[model samples]
Target: MIRLPENTTVFDDGEAVARAAAGHLRTLCEDAPNQRFAVCLSGGSTPKRLYTLLARPDYATLPWSRLHWFFGDDRAVPWDDPLSNVRMVREAFGTPSPIPETHLHPIPTADGPEAGARRYEATLKAFYGAETLDPARPLFDLVLLGLGEDGHIASLFPGKAALDETRAWAAAVPEAGMTPFVPRVTLTYPVLASARSVLFLVSGAGKQDPLARLSQGEDLPVGRIGGSPLWFVDRAAAGA
Candidate 1:
């Protein structure tokens, strides 16, 4: 485990982290002043539990009609593919969930990574009602993120060219640092930073090395995220 910042919260395990994240997310939705609220969802195993919990009674009652869902990143694959983040999220939400179909904004993967990224960028702009992002007016009410073992966030891998993106809200990764090396489209740091809140969920003993590196201030891609991120970590990841 690595040293955590003052804003970090340590949990007994991954389930505990998921529960806390769900509670915090619900609060964010309930407290939002706007009738329409946008939330950027995280991809990876860590968030599946949170999504499932949200589908359950305690959170299923949230104002799904007013909430808009967006993905932080997605592999360039068909929506129904087993490796597709969209598929994972859909299954986790379960059938007959209250979330509106039109409100779930997925990155279009029909035309490969580059085209998909461009299309997604347009979608985000349309939703944001502007081509350029304004710092004062965040694009999302909250952005959920996960820390990769290599210190990547979303699909922004460490030392990748995508990490340098500043102007574009979204970009394509021709190659990934890890397996399933398929192309991916991810929201850039600038876009990710334009959020009311950025939350990081870290779990498992396998995450210890990367967390340690982050704690030591290694300037990895995850560390480049703009806002003061809130971290939800399990004891195994925190080395508590």
Candidate 2:
């Protein structure tokens, strides 16, 4: 059987999970010594709650100005498209927030999936100041992730070509495994691995099967992620 990480936390529901994640993020930002922090954001209902919570007045003390936001992946669609992760994040974070325009780094989709992936990779390398990722100096201070029903993470579907990527920091997913079916631009495992902390936020009763399979050591996309992630799941998703 696969061993669960020691930091796994189960809450009563999705809302509770989001609240706990927000608290953890607040602490992470507050205790960080870095003059500037980089955060990789995930796209999902539960994560939207966390983003909304962070934008509220209660988290006003969070160092938003110094914190740079990056997307783990985005659909190859217009930024304003209803299915776009960028749109979801923008709506969740709300306007008139402390996050500066430059701090929010979105995956560019106008040039199509392949071009977008290349551009995003260059953007990350520029921010990291290196073409190669160094384990000693991680690229992101925190990476927030979500578990898909199909056991995917950051558009990295099981058995997809993106999973085999070792050199490129980003890749183009021509066809997604599930709904929306749009091509995607996603950060590869090598890039995601260079994170100080990774957290998986999983909820919904539909997620129980995947979580159970993971517990049984069934190989899946999310399992391949590099960092030792802390799973924050709801009771339903935890099968509790």
Model 1 residue runs over 4 Å out of place are: none
Candidate 1 local lDDT, 119-205, one digit each (tens): 999999999999898888999998999989898999999878999999899999999989889999999999988888899988898
Q: Per-prediction TM-score, please?
A: 0.97, 0.96
lDDT of 2 at 159: 84
Clash count (model 2, backbone only): 0
Query: Residue-wise lDDT of candidate 2 within 1-240, one digit each (tens)?
Result: 224446788899999999999998888887885568999999999999999988899988888889999999999999999999999999998988668999999999999999999999999999999989888999998899999999999999988999899999999999998998999998999888788889999888888878878878889988888557889988888777
What is the total number of backbone clashes in candidate 1? 0
